[model samples]
Target: MLIQTLAAAATTAAPQNKFGFVEALQAGGFIAYATVSILGIMSFGSFYILFTKFFEQQKIMRQGRDVGTSFWKAPSLRDGANKMDKNSAWRQLVDDGLAAEDQHGKMTDSMEAHDWLHGSLARSEASINARLAGGLPFLATVGATSPFIGLFGTVVGIYRALIAIGLAGSASIDKVAGPVGEALIMTALGLLVAVPAVLAYNWLQARNKRIAENLNGFSTDILANINSKGAVRPAAIAPAKSAAPAAAAPIKK
Candidate 1:
């Protein structure tokens, strides 16, 4: 009899929703939907920048690796330029250097020629680095502002909750549940948007730094090659396997 009475009372109590995301938004009206839409756009933009920049960075780095293998193997600057993709950043640098070389002949002294070539390559490298850095500011802005945007929603939700209390003349669960849930959801969504943007910004910036360093190194090599009239190239280290085979062959013979 006691168990039956408790079960009947449980069923008699108000039936609450199992999920409230939709309900909470509806309760908050236009403000809730607007906030969500803004966050959605920011999330989408952040991902787009991250992916586009990553692929671009990867392409430049891949080209840099190819330079180590094939670029130096060419006998002359004009020959090396032919071996690279015409559209590539490396190709642009070589072309600029060659152009500067041609024009530098009009200069009276060897120092003037060297300065002209160095400045041309430096300018080309700087332009490439600047291009790579283009979308990073968007990621930074999203990371910094998204949390505040979310806080605005939280503040609005809290205000709504207060209004609900005043209207009902009581702090009832039914009266304030929607607004409180909205507040929590806004906070969580803000964090979700912010963390990824911050991470991507830092990660991509680090990679850009690495790429810049490699570009600088390559620029130095190119400058040396230009000044030396293709006489100077970075010495290639023999692979350990090739050295071991040579050592063994000598002993066997």
Candidate 2:
């Protein structure tokens, strides 16, 4: 008699074992449906930003390399400056140096040369920063909001499970497990979407900063070359042809 009863209980438990969070979702609970929807959108948005940012940063680095090499090779600012595309900041700085030389004859002070170089450098810095910052807003949005979206889904799932228990007039694993399990899936999904976005954002930001430093170094080199050509004042001045100008003044006394 004991064996027969145990066998009957096992047969009844088999159907409950087959139930899962997916099966619970199919059972028409608002909580499960909403959780799935939010997770889908968050995941898609995160991936889109990741790939887009990757391409943008890669392109900028390539352009930087090209610009760096060309800036050094030009015979004079005017000659090589024209070879660079407008997007190349290093080339623009070289052009600025040439223009300053043409206007001022020579750079008497380092401060004056830097002032002439400032326009091109500032413009390049702004543009590079703008490109690097692309897609970061979306990454930030996902990181900040994905968890809340998932929590919203979880809460709904739990509430639905509680209601199901009340309506069925039972508090048993068969009725409660599926819904609770479904709710927790949302939290997991939220973390899944958020972790990568946060990490990618930090990584990209660091790379861009390094690029900025490289560009800054290049700018200094370009200016130094321009100064070398004719910008520096000679170290020694020939002594005034005879006595001081005052002594050479008419001998009124």
Candidate 3:
């Protein structure tokens, strides 16, 4: 019944009685109609980028959490590196630190430990930002460009309306309203496309910032663990003194 009613309404709008996207578009006045087409394309691409990036960032955050938890539980730095989830960005940082050093290498103290942590965290954070920022440029473009596209349609529509007025030699409500109304449709469509894109851009930026903080927290935790283990040296400290006895004696004199 609803479909039939809609069909009837569509028929009243057109001479041949058909309901379709093209037909509805034709009724939209030329400028308004063109605005719809341009905005439609931009909105499609913007949404695709927005959703895909959202899920991708979420997955990265989850994996980062897993990596941080696993690193804290491991017995040693090497062990932590091995135990961490491979997919986590933090895990990659640990891997980089370990790989940069030799088998006998160790973090030593708070400063070196901090350096390693900082480097690891910085690298991962940079990467996460890059990923999070992905496709945002397109959204920015859509937001900026859509209004102009609409304005162009409106300008064209107004031009046609003016021409019609000249040709008829009289200003009739029907003649003026139809073309002018159609042109204003383009501007409305442009706003429809731009507003959502701007909102999405702001939202994604906040999300990326939160994710960066999480990654930084993980870096600090890894460094703290390294500092804790650094304090536990050999009980005697004998080897260094014995190996440099002559040097020790000169200092004692």
Candidate 4:
């Protein structure tokens, strides 16, 4: 009798892992499966963009230090440009500025050299910004749409639960729990996917904005230097002297 009681107690105490993700998938039909698959794809894409853009931004930041030290200190604009990393945005801007100086007459001889160089640098900065902004749209899309996708799954799950209650002819715990749990899981999954994507998108965009500001400031400095010393022969600039002659008093008498 004691052995029987212990056996019964052990059986009752055994934990039941109920209708989890796999079970939901099994019972959720094609719509549920498709929704999950789409969310999975979106998650993968968001993470990929986040990581790639992160590394890319870090590279640009490191290049910023290089530009401040090596590029600015070089003797000539062309030499400064050459000192930069070959494929970096800073190098590209410098090359564009030099090219503008070289090709000043090709567009129209009437345009001032300052304006031509400014326009070229502007264009280069815009190109770099556009490149940095790539993949951001995908992250935005995922963040915006993932919740709706999850809601769709939840609605479907609830609908299935209602059908299940109808078939069982009772709204008991067993009848209500499975479908409700599945629906809640869908909602949770959707939020899980969306929150990170939104956070990552915002973070990346903020970083991009900072980088763009730096680029614009750098362009402005380059333009100022060009105006002051001329892009080609920066070393030849000389300070202007006052027109007044020194110690000219009585010699004329």
Query: How large is the C-alpha RMSD of every model relative to the true structure?
Result: 6.6, 10.8, 11.2, 5.2
Q: Residue by residue across 1-253, what tens digits does model 4's lDDT show?
A: 9999999999999988678888888778798889889999999999999999999999999998777667766788888787777889888887887787779858754888888889999999999999999999999999999999999999988998899899999888888777788798889889899999999999999999999998998887777777777443323232345787677468654
Expressed as tens digits, the lDDT of each residue in 1-253 for candidate 1 is 9999999899888696933889878887899899988988999999999999999998999998999888888888789889998888888888888888888887776667777889999999999899989989999999999998888889999999999999999999988888988998998888899999999999999999999898888887888888988877776621234444444445554
lDDT top scorer: 1
TM-score of 1: 0.85
What C-alpha lDDT do the candidate models reach, one value each?
0.88, 0.69, 0.69, 0.86
lDDT of 3 by residue, 175-225 (tens): 666667767777787888898898888888788888888767655554554
lDDT of 3: 0.69
> Ten consecutive residues with minimal summed lDDT in candidate 3?
230-239
Residue pairs in collision within model 3: none
Candidate 2 at 217: error in angstroms? 1.8
lDDT of 2 by residue, 23-74 (tens): 7677536756776787788778878878887877776578777754564455
